[model samples]
Target: MPANNPPDQPPTPGQEPDRTIAYRQHNDQPYPQGYPQQGAYQQQGQPGYPQQGAGGYQQDGYQQQNYGQQVQPGYQQQGYGQQQNYGQQAYGQQAGYQAGHQQPGYPQQNYGQQPSWQQGSDFLGTGQPTAPPAKKGRKGWLFAVIAALVVALVGGGGAFAVNLLSGGGTQPHDVLPGDALGYVRLDLDPAANQKLALFSIAQKFTVTKSSFTGDDPRKALFDLLKKDGAGLDKVDYAADIEPWLGQRVGLAVLSPAKTGGEPGFVLAVQVTDETKAKAGIDKLMDGDKYGIAFRDDYALLTANQDQADQAVKAAPLSQNTNFSDDLNALGETGVLSFWVDAGRVASFAPELAAQNSEALAQIKNVRVAGALRFDGDYVELAGVTRGAQNLDMGQPEASKIGALPASTAAAVSFSGLGDIIGKQWAQILKSADQSGAGVQQFATQAEQTYGLKLPDDLTTLLGKNLTLALDSNGLDGDQPKFGARITTDPAKAQEVVGKIEKFLAASGTAAPQLAKVPGDGTFVLASSQEYAAELAKDGGLGDDESFKLAIPDADNATFAAYVDLDKLEKFYLQNLQGEDKANAQVLRAVGISGTQSGPDASFSLRLLFN
Candidate 1:
């Protein structure tokens, strides 16, 4: 060990003394003025400290040495500027950490320079700075890509707009007779989105998916018709039907024939190729009692050749303003749509006219339009009917069922019921009797026994708005919690309730308790007083998410009904097993709502999915 070495150190046997300590001892002077303190290294070119070299930690003070290599007392190592040998290896020949020429295809990197990352080059290998490669032809390629995208978007958008304006494709009205009294059309090919939505929703349920076995719904339906024995036992769908069958099909009830028999009907089938369709029809009608006639793209089928020829000569239903207006008012047509001229149909059916002559007389003319639509979450059947003359249908009213408790599992409400009962009591009795139920006899006996008027008392009890609600709270018991609340004149409601209670007591029937709700002209007939009290409270059923989802327009509906299957499924499904239970589980709720505006009435019925 050398005596000049610091504590806890053993000097190399053949190495020179520590130069940093020896230099400071020899100078024996404080750091020069304007320079850093003793412990800090001086700036480059400052006296008493050596300038740093490219690869050396300190220049002209002590030479840089390889680890574990002994330094001779007077030996001086060269700086990076002058390459030299390290032991037997030359500086330029050392593989890594050497300040010299590099491997082929790589730039030379000086030792202790900034790393490659900061120099904008590959970091893992050399620390040399690299020039960025030119981005040749990128702008032109980018413009080409952008131009293609714009063209595709514009073309697709134009096609979509045209499809929407043209109503997707040809409709049944394009072929059926303009003067048809009744028409039912089925569109096996709906819009792409509608078809995809139907297919996606159908696939969620096993039973529905079975009916849609193929991507082409029309072919699936034709196959089903063949298998179901629809008088197509001898017809092969692939050979006879698929060759020319277009997507739209319609059945129309035409005017009575000139010979004055039953109303004639024609089935119009759209054809893609007239020649193929004619040949296919000849095969289908080989031994059948049917006749066919071709007009434009449609093949009309009738009972005989005369009827089919007459149908082709008439103006197409697409030109009928009444039919078009009615269907347009009903909004977008769905997979299945129908139109009915009520007066014309009634005039043809003498039996129906005779049975309801009074009711028919009120409406001079009526047109009905309806559609069956499918969505991802629900299936809806919607219809609209407009009458030339105002019928007994009443105005819409805000429903009180919204105030029912949130736990209500099922409810039905009606507005303008009192007026309906008052005006239609006689007709209702007649219809009831026609059904062979003896309702007139029962009503007469009830009036005599209770000493009450036929419909006047009944109307007073029913009132303007009536709602019936049932909850699952007590459904497990023998007597479920259920109640009916009616909006009526309080005094009249009380009198009618008293008369009804007395009538029930005299007849040896269990009587329900009836009472007027506080602060409102509403009366409740309930199985228990507690349920009646619940009916009176201003509850939040209207704000409940499930209620809103089920009955969206309940508040302003003339008539509405809702059932919460999610809440009641446990009780009803207790006895079910296997596929029935699984199918039932898919149903979440059901809702029906109807609105009337003057002579027009519209209604929707929806089945919601889980």
Candidate 2:
């Protein structure tokens, strides 16, 4: 609990005592006392007001002295029959104490002398009705009002403190968050062409988040406010959510806590704001709304493939299976799939599955493939492509008016200009290529293994010597042998297969030996991927380099992940250390599958460390 400051003045009677809640909480299970029990005190039927005080009960015009009256200005006395048990005989005996008084008519007292005490139309002949006593006058009334206000403040404030300490809970009768204080705090991560640029923002933000209610809503509200941005080592949300403090929302209140001395309510609510959310993601990727511009291959691919309605993706089975599933390489669209606990993911209603229809449309064919465990009520999706090779671009590289360099092409939008990168985009020409360059990358190498060749020239690129496994026999198969075709240096592989060709070249040789894990059947690479992969092999990547390289900063949440490797082996030993990292530092050493092509994928870097 936070420390307390002293009150400006001493507490009054019946006020909530300081620190009462904390003390009471120490004995949380003590029985509650003094609830307004059901049917405690109510008029049995119609209300009635008989003549004066008890003994003076007038019975149809009979009057007498103050006979047997309990004399008093401020005291009450009990009667006989009330104390006696009622048997027929006991009832008769009790009746005898009543003193059946026959009142002889006595004239009422004359009020001329003490006229001030006498009730009159004209008070004390002052021509005005008698006013309240001076002690109960305006000054007295002022004192009363001030006293009342103080009581109320103490009650309200103290109750608020108590409620906070007790977990300001909603009661069965309170309005829900969507109904009371309404707003939302949306987070966004836009799509980069490939790889994802991590992003988040702290700009002022707002949404109609509501809450449920029951007890003292003020106390409940105060309690909730205290927790609004209370996070440690996480991005602070205070500046972003403080502004939407007073808005009222409409929603249902679900569960509330039991009521006692505290006051307040808890409310769960839904919120919405598409634009701010998108911008916040921009913050995470960059600082300002539009602070930086870059590319994200993972984002573009996922969005594109999903829009295209492709559904080949998969996520990890669980944490126990995380590394293996990642290396499995089942993702077809170049999508990198992994597991996130669906049961733990929580968010507001405004950020519903229905919000990103247009973005979702971009990847019409995209699918979130995974064992049922990794999926939630819903998950955003995106596509991926390993290199330009197995992609689905419809035109030839020189289709555009002018040529573009690889780094230069990264900046230019192909949407406005056609694929003029010429040989620059030869990889795109090959995915659905009828010349079967895609299949040839594998078969030609195979034919070479049998002592044949004379096809296209393949060389000229730098790449990291990293991959999960080697085999074209689909997901489940033994590692293929290079059989003595190539060397083991990854840098060597990248330097050789960097160029593209339209005419015949090459020869044949025995397959090279395949590399495998120390003990497991897990593989490093084989003769085929060495000959077939199109992405440059030497442009080394840092372990934490931005995978997205074709768009401005953004938060692209959607993905159609693919894991290429031996499901069993990749699940255990392989690792994909990001760019600029040693092959020895693989993210996870495991077996994997190979994609004719890979898809674009995104991930929240924060959770990775977690």
Candidate 3:
């Protein structure tokens, strides 16, 4: 909190942020100021660094920040290259965050790196820092088991599949805070949803907001699940937590235990299934020109249909065929299947087979039970023997939205049951809104509220998503900033597409190039990625060989402003250093340029090149 210094501090002992770059940069991308020199975000006990490791919060005025302890917005796990094997805790547990890298060991057992990494962790796990359980002795006929997928389906009866595409069971969508790649947990018992399940649910439930926002505000998105408005009205807490004033789908899991236990099947699912709730498959207002938004999640399953079908066929069920087409389909009428745990039904449940689905069951045992986020537009139905209460009904939980007329609620659910997860997710976001911190303050407050110590690493992921959402929402831009442009560029467009691959690899936000080209046209990035109009204007445009080829319309800047070295020097000498707040001034005007012609057409594009 020193007045002279910036918020981020230098690296500390053992807490140094990884400064080594494994690969060489072909181009010279300027590092943010004080970047390698180390800013305020260092770990504790590092060489030449100060001993500051509390909350990095200052009391009065002059205190060095403990970068080690400073909760940042995008803290991710660091990985050292591939390790020969799963070593003792020593090599695994480093003091501070390291950039996720592959270790040299683990030739036999695969180790997962954290979420941001793109390469193989050798193991299927991301570098999430989990202590995987030890493998038992190899069992006989393992290959035989692997070879029995299709036949297994015939034997087991449930047409099931495990999809590696759609990012391994995760529906294609903006990567949200909890969207880190992970394993599917299969469990059984009385159905009551939980957070993990709700997250899975959100991944599946897709909605068409007149205008959507966020990495994916699906946390409390299940409020749209209403059969007759009864489900949404079940819990009075939806409106308080959800966003956009939507309805709660009444998605909940009533499991057997009150504490740590495996998540059972989705106990109650009351999603609003509009759009016929199935793959449009050559059927659409646009004539199934690819599935619609609600159907997008299901459509992603196409990438791994073969593998998924094989997996599904291996699951136990009565009769199954849809397995071939809808590799993710798991439902009745002699058709059953198994699916990778991407938020559909949890492991198999054997008891509630007859209930098919609970209808108007009293909320007797409901404690607002935990929630799960379902991803994609797919159905999972397994035929286990049934008892009095049926557990696995994909009814969307009701809470993200509120007060829907029964019919309206059902309409919403049937049409956008997939999107219900979106509504449900909107609610979880409220937990961040408390005390104005919203998610930014979660690291400090979450311990008491959620009862678990969610580290800053995870909080940063959430905060970044929230920040992007808020920025896009224009609550900050309702009036609109005249300086920002809303046009596109071809070369920049290409950059927009490439950035996703880069960002996902490092979880680092890169400026969008397409937004920089000053013009009047729609730039299309990959179908999935979006562009930030403002940042694009700031990136500056380019007219290279590729640019002239793709950009249908291109014109020289009606007004141009190259990097003004003299003006920058004068401004810095005259106003910055002379004033105590020079730090802030330097941050605003450092190494950036802009050009303007029409009131809104011109932009800052030179920075990308020079």
Candidate 4:
């Protein structure tokens, strides 16, 4: 490390340090200064330049700098139509540090032919290089990009709608995180949301001015109604109930039950003052009203009468520690959240329930929760899933999928692979037997068709844990590269490989190459020998910072996955057309993890954006 250089340590969370944008000015016995000091830079007040904020870019007072003998001539008009030129120096030319030194690649300046460029105002010394100006239309392009993001985020009115449904309150006072099978929390109050940098910046472009004027959202609603010729002028939401509006809101996905041929679910919200809330509701219902019920601070607002009734009858999250813990696993709190009760949902949703009864039965006992928060370059979403007693997450074996390489485009690891496959396979055979699709004769038919001895049972051929990963480097090639790592019993490993090879041969496909890595009987199956060799290398995601940040406690998780958002963006840009490619660039990375404790399991996903 050079003495004059700053520390190279990467930033810790919430600790972004200053990044040197310009070379430091030279001082003492010596060489000409490279650039001006902080103080001088602050005085520039350059337009379009970002001002210093609490966390970044503080400007100090200016200090004089020096320029040595390599000084070049100024200005040449390349004409406005071309990339803007800032005089003869080509805008980016600068003298080397040593006396009479000139940086390479720059055309030697001819003093005799030098054109006059603006002087004195240039804080950078005469010979010092100037920062290149932004390209034409760059600012407009950036604004458009940001506007698109804002519109997409605001689209669906879903942000507000979710908050409204879940009781958007500052505290989990009325309904605990566990009150519903799943819930989403969002900061819907315009004032509160604006505090967030994303919202704050977006608001600059958004129309903050309401039609009716003033700060009340009710007034804004009325004004909007009037614009549609609803004649809402007589309504006075402010006088009726604006005082009870809460800053934060939540939306909950309650346990499911069958209702009216549709999967039943309760959507609930929180009310600050029941009396005032009802009055406000009554006012809104003046034209057409839906049933509204209240329990404590929560308000049940759904068109489905039975679902609404069930919401009022069900146990609130306040009483369930499992549900609460699942929510807490996502985050103690967040701007917005979402949840799903796999078991409960499977019971009522006919489509889901119709899956192999065995598979559906296994899935029914799980509960999932997710949350959101604002963090560097990403709008993160965290999720959690819990499982039931009958469900197996391959506990004894657990998952030794280890870490994926940092560059992995996508990865998924799960335990209970054997158990799940075995169960599903059994169910398939049973259904086939009953449907006359094959049953007892299926195994023989499969063997004859594929010309391989098809095992009647699959559990014996696979392991408890499995990991599937893909790298970006592969997708661009003739065949997309992939890695499938499985943890099998050492005794059965050879037989398993043999079976797979035979199966592939029979199917008229190339056999996947494989390599054993150092872990609990773990081996890699890759699309090619090169990929297999690469998989044998170290640096599996185990120690990657991004992986750790996204999915902690991997060993305990029943399932985990990671997606390199940066790579995905690149892939999308290369393969996808239309606006989607542009929109895809916004994400940076995504990670998902799930852990089960007894009958309940929690799952979470973290999404990072650029």
Q: Number of the top candidate by TM-score?
A: 1
lDDT per residue as tens, model 2, 420-440:
222324433444364456754
List model 4 lDDT by residue over 346-417, tens digit each. Answer: 666665556467667767667776655443334455556666556544443444444556567778887776
Lowest-scoring 10 consecutive residues by lDDT in candidate 1?
113-122
Reference-based TM-score of each model: 0.67, 0.17, 0.16, 0.55
Error of 4 at 407 (Å): 4.5
The alpha-carbon lDDT assigned to residue 297 of candidate 4 equals 65
Pairs clashing in candidate 1?
none
Instruction: Encode model 1's per-residue lDDT on 1-610: one tens digit a residue.
Output: 1112222233345432322121222232432211111112112333333444232223466333232234443333432222233366433311122223232333333333211111112221222214331222322342233222222211122122112112234566776789998899776544333332343354344344333111344555556677887777777778887789875688998877543357889998989998899888877776777878887677999998887877888888877888867875775455678899987777666676777877676664888999876555666788899874746656646677788888899999888878878877878888888899887787788788886776888887778888899987898788788988888876777777777888889989986554445337878777788888988777778997767766767777778888989999997676756545655677788988877766888888888876
Put down candidate 3 lDDT per residue, 1-610, tens digits, no spaces. Answer: 1101111222233422222111111222332211111222233333442322122212233333332234344432222222211234222322122223222331212223211112222112222213332222222132222122112211111100011001111111111111111112121110111111222222221111011111122232233344345344433333322222211111112232333344322211112343333322222122322211222122212212442343222322111222111221211111111222112222124332233223223211111101111111111121211111222322322111111111110100011222323433433345346336565354445445433333322322221111111111222333321122222234443443353445444545554333233234322221112333433322222323222222212333222222222223443344432222221222111111112221111122211110
Q: State model 2's lDDT.
A: 0.22
lDDT of each: 0.61, 0.22, 0.23, 0.48
Worst 10 residues of 3 by lDDT: 157-166
